[model samples]
Target chain A: MAVRNRLTGERTHVPSAVGRRSRVASGPHDRHHEIIDAALELFATIGYSGTTMAQIGDRLGMRGPSLYKHIASKQELLVEIVTGMMDELLRRQRAALAEGGDVRQRLSSIVAVHVQYHAEHRYEAFVGHREIDSLEEPHRSHILDLRREYESRFRELVQEGRGLDLFRTSSDRWSSYAILDMGIGVSAWYNPSGSVTPDELAATYAELALRMLGAERGD
Target chain B: MAVRNRLTGERTHVPSAVGRRSRVASGPHDRHHEIIDAALELFATIGYSGTTMAQIGDRLGMRGPSLYKHIASKQELLVEIVTGMMDELLRRQRAALAEGGDVRQRLSSIVAVHVQYHAEHRYEAFVGHREIDSLEEPHRSHILDLRREYESRFRELVQEGRGLDLFRTSSDRWSSYAILDMGIGVSAWYNPSGSVTPDELAATYAELALRMLGAERGD
Candidate 1:
């Protein structure tokens, strides 16, 4: 099965039984990426607790024991996929915020980036949001901290826009949640084959976000 | 432990080890509700596939075999909980829409009801969204039909508002998704002890929804 790498938007092939027989030499780094992608695909399809390491090996056409060479355990795979996703989201959000337009432009950019990321990384978004409880201990707290920081970026924009009088909102906090939640929701229902493209969906959501904030100008 | 009944939102007491000794007489109907509530609480805390009838019985201080008297299987419990939620949502949505109001008022009432239902029934909302995959066959499709019907109520309002020149939206479909998703998200993050009451949160979200639709007037 071919699974898309969560970190990079690239397809990584996990060989089927027939394809495994014709495999050529692949580097450990490539193997590591393939294993993570395979695990991500399974984790999203099946619940984390319901997925087994052996099933992941089966999907990749590797022996269960041989799979340990690339990854330690199932929980570690979840940690990697989720944290990697959050890290990427935070990176993009920072870049978007730094590419300053006025507050309206920045808010729109942020919402657009958010919607696009959730749409593009649907599997990561699914597992990240659904499997947060399964992520153990310090890793869970760390991921949550990252999420809070990411959410604050939206809230900060709303506050900034409010201060500048460019936006009028009933409550900056709830407005930010409404905006962010709606964008996060893209992951649940976005269909790549659907008429709306990710970029177009992102643009529409951005317009909705601006409208939600009562922005002075129309997009 | 006391579990809140999903259907009625009443707190049903499931006796602890000590409390089980002092239990008063309860009818089978009451026992059935208590069992369902316990199962709902457990399913929300632990994923559906992870929970067992043994744990449900344990939580309610009944022998595992005794549970068969109340419910047939774990899947039945899920079917009941999910379908019950969808049914109730459909009922409330119809009531909200049937109340005579302009398009704006009707839309606001529907959003308010949705946000408040999700906030009050957080456990049901959590399980309904996350455990849809766990629900079997015809039941799943049936619940989904109810959901589509419920969503159309909002979309119809948006379309009506547009026809009346009260709402100017980029796309009626995406706008409805944005409005509904934002309200559904209250289930994930709403804190009962927070400064904002559910009614207050509902009002704020309704305002945001109107703003998102580019409604002509403010609340």
Candidate 2:
């Protein structure tokens, strides 16, 4: 069966292996990454449900058949985008924790990094927050588990801070939620081009997190 | 022009005033309010772009033509839902401020009420936050102005608190954003059926907000 390319309107019998390999041979980078980027841009802008495969193809100057050669489905793109973001976040957070500070310093570092990530990578953050419900099945459960693990870092920091008498919190769980939520909210409005730089916003949020946890001023 | 009712299998020449009046005669309430409620639920659950007038009519056991009698269009429903929420929030916040206390007490009352509103009216909050971008023209600007006016309340409190030496904040602007964002986040995750009651959540956040401002514990 002949398939008409959505972008160029050219007829292709199918997504040929030669066609896929030839596209990458002409460029140093793989088409898979490009496809994901286009999908992410569309998903973040028009929303997951509002976007279509044809639009993603149109964005990339690729036909529908060729686009499928790189991605299994739109849902796959969402899964890739969300899961990729979570993995990177977990990796960065672990590195921040490993650099090691006292509880106050450690919490401040993590909060700063969290705020910075949300501000710098606002599109990814927006999609992850908005399209979590759009994720399907095992990917949905897996991403949620990863998120819970990420949140546990904050919870543990608060618990350790409280134990050391450095942080005064009425409830450890709620305090952690408040800190994380405030940072997450940054993505909704933070502009890198604005007066406040990402680093500056991160530092401001870090101080706010410490205050919310009731850390002593002298400490 | 004849139109088919999406809900009930009937033909209506047009939205009849007598038909519209008869529906309300059976009850003491207006269909306009009920239509808004159904639209709110659909907008919050599916999304503004994803929801349809037919689906809203189906939710209310009314037909499309009759539904049109109560609302001008889907955009009108959105404008009402979002503007109504902002108006109600402004009213409640003004009342909270009017029942004034010291800076700490006033801020606490406002934060508590903010959290409570988000927790209890989660759907309205969700729609307002998610669908703000979907708003059109004059309504979009109108709602945003109302939001700015509402946010000014928080900024003013922080400014007042700082002036009186009751609150210590690194940046008055950042501190207010943190407090408001944290409370707004509650709408995304708060569960009325959960072990934590709305009042409990509000009180916890209020304390957090106070601490964030660096209010003295003794006060």
Candidate 3:
């Protein structure tokens, strides 16, 4: 799986001006990023219910109610974090689809994007997988809708392969589920400090995924 | 996938009557089962740390200290629940292996056993997957050993398929991971009340698993 430039987004590092404003204006965007980072770490370690605003505030070197100044409630915080993660995933998927490639290449690109996203943003992936039900009605539905769209990309690719007589699987839906499950499982055990880079892991997983769907390698 | 007895052990559900001297032990075995049942539900819902002995006691209509009289510690409770679940899995895996079938049949049987075990024992499976790491040292290692042994059964089947020329996949390890991940993922979202029975889901998953390994039917 080739790493496409489109898959790369702007680095999240704060600029000098933004850093100065973070100390002065108490910017919503800066506070939003802080809340997300803190929530991600807490959610990963203690899970959703086990984490609280007090604990999140402790991590941010602020008091409990100070967190409310930035975010409304714990459920709201959860929705924001989950929605942010899903939105990023949607962004990556769109970028992968937009890049110039054949069906096989595009599918591989999608797998790579998924693997890389999960590996680099494991906290978000964990929250996404585990805490979806914590969101309220509209937010929950919106996130689930985005997730369905993300999954449809893989299903469409599988159908394309079937159209080319490359895949003879019984059900495309389950095939897509299997592939997505494998990709998501990467977050549970993948260690960046290990031998394989995220790109290499993505490549390995993409190859396996293609083989699972009976896609032949195009020389 | 035939439900054959393979473990070569006593299939008898011997109710342990040794520890019923306490007031909490009207029927030691029944009470023990009840404790495990409640623990599984609480662990799956609120997670390990979020669950307390007090909550467990309240759920069972007993006090906190009473629970200690039955199980030594919360850690012990976790170990007992996980061990019971793993033991059942081992039994199913042995049965699948002992059915004396071809590579494809054996592989399907293994997948079926895995999915069926999780589907039938959803609470146990959920606790085993999510709260396993919360177990302390020796107990943790014990469960890990059993899990490795269980995984080896499937790995051996994959190797057997490779030796029999039934698999077209390049990497046996990846193939095994894919099948195992698919089975474990089933536990995360499977609803017994849904349209598909555990047996049907197992059959579907097994078919997909075999296809992923490039195992042709009847091969």
Using lDDT, give the best candidate's number. Answer: 1
Candidate 2 vs candidate 3: the lDDT winner is: 2
Give the alpha carbon lDDT tens digit for every residue of A44-163 in model 3.
767787788889888777778878877778888788788889989999999988995888889889998998888888888978887775667998889889998999999999898888
Where does the lowest 10-residue lDDT sum fall in candidate 2 chain B?
B12-21
**Ten residues in sequence with the least summed lDDT for candidate 1 chain A:** A15-24
List ranges where model 2 is wrong by over 4 Å: A1-30, A52-69, A217-219, B1-30, B53-58, B61-66
Fraction of real interface contacts that model 1 preserves = 0.79
Better of 1 and 2 by lDDT: 1
Best by DockQ: 1
Residue by residue across A1-219, what tens digits does model 1's lDDT show? 655455676655665444332234555437778888988988888779878888888877777778888778778899999999999999999999899989999999999999999999989988898899899999999999999999999999999999999999978999999998898888888888889888999999999999889899844
TM-score of each: 0.85, 0.82, 0.72
Listed in order, the DockQ scores are 0.60, 0.53, 0.29
> How large is the C-alpha RMSD of every model relative to the true structure?
9.9, 5.9, 14.4
Residue-by-residue lDDT tens digits, candidate 2, B1-219: 455446576654553345444554656457788888889989987889878888998887767676877778889889988988888888899899899778889989899999988898888998998888788888888988998998888889999999989888888888898898898988888877889988899999999999889887654
> By lDDT, highest first, what's the ranking?
1, 2, 3
TM-score of chain B of 3: 0.83
lDDT of each: 0.87, 0.86, 0.80
Which lDDT tens digits does candidate 1 get at residues B97-215? 88968999999999999998888888898899889888889988988888888999889999999998999997899999999999888888888888988889888898889989999
Q: For candidate 3 chain B, which ten residues in a row score worst on lDDT?
A: B12-21
